[model samples]
Target: MSQEATFKSIVCEIFGIQEGDVADTKTPEDIESWTSVTHMQLVARFEESFKFQFDVEEITEMDSIASMKNVLRKHGVDL
Candidate 1:
């Protein structure tokens, strides 16, 4: 799958949401499963899947799916 699809799948699985529910606009404030602990878990999962670690700024700015994609891309993840 493409990086975008992989990202979406991972987010959906981590958030316990459906594929159709995953969107760029989705944020922690908008999703019930996106708690602090779960957010960290998601971050870890993303790092594992993409084989890269997010720095403090990247992690803090990843408040939404779109933001996460941007950060990943900035780190050389093709998406």
Candidate 2:
């Protein structure tokens, strides 16, 4: 799989969403599996999966798949 696919897979699995349903338009409001603890868990998972750290602000601000992609880009995740 490509990096984008890897990222999307990680996010989708962490949030308990199907890969087919995990689009850029997806948001926390659209996923019942999303919650504060879920976000923190996701942050940790992303850090481990990407082998880089992210600021809490960035973590807290990721309310959508698109936002997560932006954060990943900002951290030089190679899209």
Candidate 3:
């Protein structure tokens, strides 16, 4: 699958939501399941699936799907 598709899948799974419910603008404030623990779980899952490690700064900056995409782009990921 494409990176965007994979990303949505992971987020949906972690948040226990449907694919249609995910959007780049969504943040922890929008999703009840997006707690601090699930946030790290997302980091771990993204690191594993994308094969890149996120530094502390990047981790802190990833409060939304758009931010995560930005950090992935910085790491040379296309989407």
Q: Highest TM-score: which candidate?
A: 3
Backbone clash total for model 3 is 0
Distance from true location, Cα of 51 in model 1, Å: 0.8
The runs of at least 3 residues in candidate 3 whose Cα sits more than 4 Å from the true structure, single-residue gaps closed, are none
| lDDT measured at residue 19 in model 2 versus the true structure, 0 to 100 | 82
For model 2, how does the per-residue alpha-carbon lDDT over 13-65 read when each residue is reduced to its tens digit? 87888888887888878888888888888889889988899987988778888
Each candidate structure's TM-score, on Cα atoms with residue i matched to residue i, is 0.91, 0.87, 0.92
Residue-wise C-alpha lDDT for candidate 1, range 1-79, written one tens digit per residue: 8888888888888899998888889888889999999999989998998898899988999998899889999988888
Span of ten consecutive residues with least summed lDDT in model 1: 1-10
lDDT of each: 0.89, 0.84, 0.90
Model 3, position 59, has a per-residue lDDT of 99
What ranges in model 1 sit over 4 Å off? Answer: none
Q: lDDT score, residue 27, model 1? A: 88
**Positional deviation of residue 75's Cα in model 2 after best superposition, in angstroms:** 1.1
| Tens digits of per-residue lDDT for model 3, 1-79 | 9988888889899889999878889889989999999998999998999999999999999998889889988987767
Clashing pairs in 2: none
Clashing pairs in 3: none
Q: Quick one: best lDDT, which candidate? A: 3
